[model samples]
Target: MIKKPPFVVLSKISDQIARLETEVAVASPTLANVYNDLQCQIDVVVANLEPLQTISGHIEIVERSMETILDFLSSSGDKSISAANVYSLLEPLHAKIHQQGEQLRKIV
Candidate 1:
């Protein structure tokens, strides 16, 4: 049998997940559980697309970012981090960084 492209398989899985999520919404108290499970399953599948070294590098960056964020928050004294700071400033900066990283990766 001819093998389908990975995107085809992933698209089918995505459709199935959409259906499952709808079912979960109808039967469960909240959708967060379904979303978390779907995210984990997708992560497992996507891990196969990258080398272990690359995956570990990305993971290290995320780990370091979490540590740095926590450290800053802890040492900020009376200064505070607000949702506005995150949503208005940090998140957009993060998105730009990720977009640039993805563009550069595509060039390689």
Candidate 2:
């Protein structure tokens, strides 16, 4: 089986995160606290990854993060979603992505 390039995977993950952000914004404007920081972090990761020519080394981390985010979104349609809850759910992933970006910077 052929694999996609890292940039394509990152782009798709970025798109998914953006879509989720928009849905959260519209569905729960009051939960801006939940998604605003996440959006910012994601923006930073995308920006860092966008110009890279050597992200293949970090694709696994990126893909795992994408899966975590997708799973959270899928199982969170209930009204139990709170600012703190979402924040906690996404914080580890955000940190991981942020760290990955830093690593990429050092490598480039």
Candidate 3:
């Protein structure tokens, strides 16, 4: 068995390193473009989510207002309560409004 000198082994290793470097360098631009595309997609996703978040917040505010109104009406005793029930009249409306608002929010 023959052992190679240290300098010869080092030279071979350097050649292999150079070849690898060249391969990576050649592919670098394509890799960079792919990275940029992924970044753009992420940006688009984040940008799209903003409007939905805003709409959800707005819907929450409206729901809270409706709840407050319902509470206020319940607290205030009505003289003509026998004719029409407040909960029956308003509960459906609040549910409908909340449902529609939620749908709209999702569309955003």
Worst 10 residues of 1 by lDDT: 47-56
For residues 2-92, what per-residue lDDT tens digits would candidate 3 score against the true structure? 8974445544555554555556557796765555555455555555655555666666776787787668777777645643566765666
Q: Candidate 2: list runs displaced more than 4 Å.
A: 1-59
Q: Model 3 clash pairs?
A: none
Residue pairs clashing in model 1 are none
The candidate that wins on TM-score is 3
Highest lDDT among the candidates is held by which one? 2
lDDT for each residue of candidate 1 in 25-85, tens digit (9 for 90 to 100) = 7678478476658856775665554443464466567667767776877798788678776
lDDT of each: 0.64, 0.71, 0.62
Better of 2 and 3 by TM-score: 3
* Per-residue alpha-carbon lDDT of candidate 2 for residues 1-108, written as tens digits (9 for 90 to 100): 779866577677767767777888877876755666766776777676665654554657777877887798887787466779778767877787787788777856
In model 1, what lDDT does residue 82 have?
Answer: 85
TM-score of 2: 0.39
List the candidate 3 regions with Cα displacement exceeding 4 Å: 1-27, 81-108
